[model samples]
Target chain A: MLEITDIVTSYGKIEALKGVSLSVAPGKITCLLGPNGAGKTTTMMTVAGLLKPRRGNIAFEERNITGRDPGHIVQSGIALVPENRLVFPDMTVHDNLRTGAYSRSDDEIEDDIARMFERFPRLHERQEQHAGTLSGGEQQMLAVARALMARPKLLLMDEPSLGLAPLIVEEIFRIIRDLNAEGTSIFLVEQNVHQALKVAHYFYLLEQGRVTFGGSPGDLEEDEVIQRAYLGSAEQT
Target chain B: MEFVDYLQAVTDGVMQGAYYALIGIGFTLIFGVMNKINLAYAAAAFGGAYASLGVAALIGTGDDFGLPPLIMFLVSAIAAGLFAWIVYTICFRFTPDHYELATLMATVGAFFLIEEIAVHSTAGEPMDFPEVLQGIVDDPMIEFSDAFAIRGDLLTIFLLALIAMGLLLMLLYRTKLGLATRAVAQQRTAAQLCGISVDRTNATTFIIAGVLGGLAGAMIGAAVGVLSPLLFVPLTVKGLIVTVIGGLGSIPGAIVAGLLVGGLENVFLALRGITERDMYVMLLLFLFLAFRPQGLFGKKAVRD
Candidate 1:
């Protein structure tokens, strides 16, 4: 479980996250929904320890992890699949997977890599090819598989579906659900409201660096603002 | 008849190019990881050379050059690595990652600082450097033909440079630290997310480049048989040119460009004499900058 309290993160004079608070329950897929510039990616980055928060604290499993280095955060069992699938372009897909496990010294890393290849068979087929040469969908899959290489207790993914095809989006949602069912908690940031609603048990709506609403997906269906802003009509909402 | 002369020039140029490649690779390694140019690199390298020469003086080999070439090289390389560590701490470590210009300017400052120290100490006088094969044999030149031959010292330095490059390639491609380094170089934030320490990797990178730079300095000093403050600026300029022509972040590119530049420099020297030789080299750099700025093997995106 992860709990964030009044975290304020900034870029020079401008603040991206202003007193934002949220919680991700254990063994569940919790989704964060927000418009562009709503500080969604900023929050994920902050929790991943890439950006040090200006205020407040983040606790994972009741231990304060605020302002820790990203390496320490990963060692504490949290891994992030950053937005835009930042796979190493010049490195081969296999090398990309190898880097994902950089923090661990366990001997089972090869076994875990094998597991990743099995789950994402296309990655296995293209193991020696440069990641930059992969398609958008394949790259996204590689990103998720790479993150899974860390064997984290919690997986933080920022917009894994952005720019993906509809079928690929469906596949991504399926992977998220599958990952959660397999006992890896997921904290996902998504722009695809419908697909996210179908899979996310709990969701938070962030607006302008603040959390506006938090509830079950059923409760989300009744919110007029969210329906209008994210979903086109009440029926689809 | 002219072909034999050009061939001889190329052979000598390759021997010289080995040192150039070492220097260029030093620049390329640091640039690949940090994406920030450390102008102090060459100064640190030559600083290592001067330190070894100082050691030679202390050991009473100041006049006769009785010290073995191997020990001199090792001492110079280690000292250079230390100098680089100082540069990294002062210029890069505390500087905020986003403020790249700060690091660049700081390195430029470090460069002048080291060069000034060397100048003040040596009083702008050139010191003699030990030759690798001077005392080993009576005839120090290996001849393939009447027109083609390599000095025993140059040949030894060339072989040593090749060995160093081979070891470097092995370290990069075969080791876990190298994997971390390459990962960090490719995607800093992503590497961080994967729990790679960017600071540690950067520091390690600086030291590695420093050692390699030191080796390059020793090799150049050995080849030219002198340690002069005047050689620092020109060699540093050549190193940068090698980095650009090889491709900013490409090691293989650096190696090829170094040899190409070295060979071409010699060919030009054979045809046009010394003053115009550098002019042609500068012209080659200008052509590269104009037409293939990404360099022979660098990805175009590196220009971004």
Candidate 2:
């Protein structure tokens, strides 16, 4: 479980997150949805310890993790699949997977890698190819699979479907659902509202660095203003 | 020129190129991983040369506490690595984050500090370093003709570089540490999320570079038979020129560029003179920057 309380993050003169707050229960796919420039990515980055918060606390399983180094945060069992599927472009797919377990000293890393290959057969096929040379869908799959190599208690994914094709997006959503079903907690930041809602057990709408709406999918779908706000023209149908 | 004379020049150039490659690789590796040019690397190399010479002197004096040549080399390497770590910690680490200009200035300052230390210690005089591979291999009779010959030192340097390159390639391609290092270089944030400590990785990278530089400095000192602090600045400049011409982050590029620069510099010196040789090299660097800023193999910088 992860808890964030009144966190503010800034980038020099620009204040990115102003007093934002949220919570993620264990073993659930919690979706944070917002339009562009809504600070959704900032929230995920802050939680992952890539960016320090100016104020407030972030805790994992009741342990305060706010201001901890990113490596320490990861060692504590959180892994982030960053935005844009930022795989190490020059590294081979196999090398990228190994990097995901950089903190683990255990001998079963190869076994874990094999397990990830089993989970995503496509990754196995392109195991030796440079990750940059992969297709967008394949690269996204590699990114997610690479993060799973960390054996993370919590997976933070930022816009996993940003530039993928529709079919690839569906496959990614299916993988997210399957991952949640297998009992790994996911904090998914997505723009694809319909697909995110289908997989997300709980949803929050972030607007200008604040949580504007928080409820179950049913509640979100029923609320006329919330539906109009997120779905736009799709809501008329 | 005679065929044998031409051959001798080519052989010498190739050996010199290997030393240049060693230094150039150090420059490129640090730039690749940290995005900071360690202008102090050549100073670190000079410091290692002095340490090697010091060890050699102590051993020659029949000091029972002295180490063998190979162990002395290792000691020199470790000493250089520790010096580099200290320089990085003092100059770059504690500085404000992401201020690359400030870091560059700090490294340049460290470079002067080390160079001054070497000058003060040696009283601005050149010191002869003890040869590890002495009369046994220093000048094996390789006679091509009456006018041309080759020394065993050149051959040794060339072979050593080949072995170093082979090992470096293997370490990079076959090791988990290399994987993590590449990951950190590519994406520090993602690497950290995978539990790689950025600071530790960076320190290890610097140490590796320092070791390479130490070996290079020892080779140069052995070949020239004299080590001077005055060589540091020019070596640093030449190494940086090679790094830029090769590419900012490409390993193979550095090796190729190093040889090209070394060979051409000699050829120019043979034709025009030493005074004008550096002008041509600088011109080449300018042309590369103007036409192909990424060099032969570097990727274009991607904006986030």
Candidate 3:
């Protein structure tokens, strides 16, 4: 479980996340939905320790993790599939997965890599190929598999389905559901509201560096702002 | 010009290329990790070499109770690594990451700062460097005909460089640190996201390159039989030339390009005079920039 309380993060002169607050319960697929430049990625980055907050704090399972180094945060059992699936392009798929397990010196690394290959068969077929040469869908799958290699208690994914084809997006969602079923808590940031609403047990809408709304999908349908801003587009699609 | 003379020129050039390869490897390694050039690298290396000379002068390399030849290398390497750490702290650690120019300027400042330090300490005077294989007819030469021969001292330095290069490759390809380094080089954000301490990795990379620079400094000193601050600038320029022609971040590229540049420099020296020799090498670099900017063995533009 993770709790973010009124955290403010900024670039040089501009505030990207201003007093934003949210929570992700354990064993659930919690989704953050917002339009472009709504600070969705900023929230993910701040929680992942890529960005430092100027105000407030973040607690992971009651442990303060605010402003820690990314290494410490990852070691605390949180893994992030960053926006754009930033897999090391020059590295082979196998090495990429190996790097995912960089913090762990356990004997089961190869075993976990094998398990990742089993789950993503396409990855097994191209394990030795450079990740940059893989297709966009394949790269996304590799990114997910790489994050999973960390064996984190909590998984943070930012825009996993961005720029993905419809069929591939569906497959990604299926994997998200399967991962949640396996007891890995997921805090996902998504723009595809209709698909996200289907899988997310609880959701929050982020707009302009603030959390505008938070509720179950059922409550989403009843909210007027959600009806016009998000579901309106989902229904049209 | 005789065919044997040309062959001799190339052979000597290749031997000298070993030192260039060592220096260029240091340059490429630093570039690979931080994606920024350290202009102070050669100065750090010369500083190490000069420190070793001071050690040699104090302890003596001539008698039964004297310092072993191996200590000289160790002193140079450790000293260079220390200087590199200082360079990292001053030039790289505090500078903002996104603005690469700041780091670049910082390193340029470091170059002059370090060079000035070395100059003040040594008083801009050249000192004799201890030679390997000290006693031999013609200082020991391997004859391939009367016209072509390899100087024993240079051959020893070349072989030592070869061994150093072999160990470096093993460290890079067969270790966890190397894996983290490569990951950081490929994607800094992704590497951090994977829980790698990018700062530690970058710092370690600087030290590793520094060690290589020290070895190169020792080699250059041994081959020339002298150590001087004046050699720093020319060596720095040559090292950069090697890095670019080898590609920015490729180790194998550095080796191959080092040899190529070395061989070409000598062949030009043999064809023209010393002044025109560098002109050809510069022209070669310009041609590479105009045509294959990536250099031999360099990867095409990296994807985000």
User: Which model scores highest in TM-score?
Assistant: 1
> How far in Å is the alpha carbon of B253 misplaced in model 1?
0.7
Given candidate 3, what's the lDDT at residue B1? 92
Provide the TM-score, chain A, model 1: 0.95
lDDT of 3 by residue, B122-198 (tens): 78788777676654345478877788898887788788888988998888778888889999999999999999998
Query: Which portions of model 1 miss their true places by more than 4 Å?
Result: A222-237
Q: Which candidate number has the best lDDT?
A: 1
Q: Per-residue alpha-carbon lDDT of model 1 for B1-304, expressed as tens digits? A: 3898999888899889988898899899999999989888999999999998888888864267656877899989999999999999999999987898999999889999999999999999998898888677889988888877878888888889899999999998888899889988988888899999988899999898888888989898898989988988888999999999999978999899989999999999999999899899999999999999998888886511
Error of 3 at B67 (Å): 3.3
Write down the TM-score of every candidate. 0.96, 0.93, 0.95
lDDT of 2 by residue, B1-304 (tens): 5556556666677678888898899899888888889999989977987887787676666533254445555666777877778777877678876888898899999999999999998999997765556645545657767777766766777788778777877877788778878888888777887888888888888888888888788778777878898799889988998899889978898899888888777766666678998888788889999998888777787523
Better of 2 and 3 by DockQ: 3
In Å, residue A74's CA in model 2 sits off its true spot by 1.9
Interface RMSD, Å, model 3: 0.6
Each model's fraction of native contacts: 0.89, 0.83, 0.89
TM-score of 1: 0.96
- Candidate 3, after superposition: displacement of residue B62 in Å? 8.5
Better of 1 and 2 by lDDT: 1
Candidate 2 C-alpha lDDT tens digits along A1-237: 899999999998788888888899899999898767778899988988889999999999999999898888888888888998888888889999988888788999999999989989999999999998899899999999888888898999999999999999999999998898898999999887878888888888877677777888888553543454354334223
Output the worst ten-in-a-row residue range by lDDT, candidate 2 chain B.
B62-71
